[model samples]
Target: MAAVSLSVSTVKPLGDRIFIKVSEAEAKTAGGILLPDNAQEKPQVGEVTAVGPGKRSDDGTRQELDVKVGDKVLYSKYAGTEVKLAGEEYILLSEKDILAVVA
Candidate 1:
């Protein structure tokens, strides 16, 4: 079967964690073909496809997540642990590693 990169289903995160699907940029193509690996753009952006529940603090209060699933986000160049889902690459990281949300 052919692979589908994006999914509409929901994936709830566990705690203080999030699941993001890195967005692949369009390859620089001249003859309608993709560019070589060296010519591709560096990955720096992704969409939050899943989010964990709020984490509990020492005070017993739940700290809510700043980001939610479907939110476009920016992360550090070397941040996040890379993961694979449904044959696609994903990133698992804490909210701290995320630099900003793309609005």
Candidate 2:
């Protein structure tokens, strides 16, 4: 038998959470000089690729998620857990960590 691999192009996070792919860091600044890899700040914006089933509140009701898949979101500079899927890097975070959904 041949080895089989499963390609998960999509994932569903659970409970007030979401999955996003971090944007690439800027390679240069307006000063016209290239910045070192470490000099660039970690990107805070990313495109939402997956969403979770809303969380349950104490009231016995589920809180609805605000962001949807394909929405560009801005998150905190120091939030989310880094993970790898299908050989691609991704982040799993709670919706609360998301600062804003890009208009």
Best by TM-score: 2
Candidate 1 structure quality by residue, lDDT tens digits, 1-103: 9965544244556778888899996686667987887878768899998888878899998899999878999998888788776678888888888999997
lDDT of 2 by residue, 1-103 (tens): 9975634364668899898988888899988889998899888998998888899999989989998889999999889998776776678999889999898
User: How do all models score by TM-score?
Assistant: 0.75, 0.84
Q: Which lDDT value does model 1 have at 88?
A: 80
Name the runs in model 2 displaced over 4 angstroms: 1-10
Error of 1 at 20 (Å): 0.2
After TM-score superposition, the amount by which residue 73's alpha carbon in candidate 1 deviates from its true location, in angstroms, is: 0.5
- Per-residue error (Å), model 1, residue 70: 0.8
Report the error of model 1 at residue 31, Å. Answer: 14
**Ten consecutive residues with minimal summed lDDT in candidate 1?**
4-13
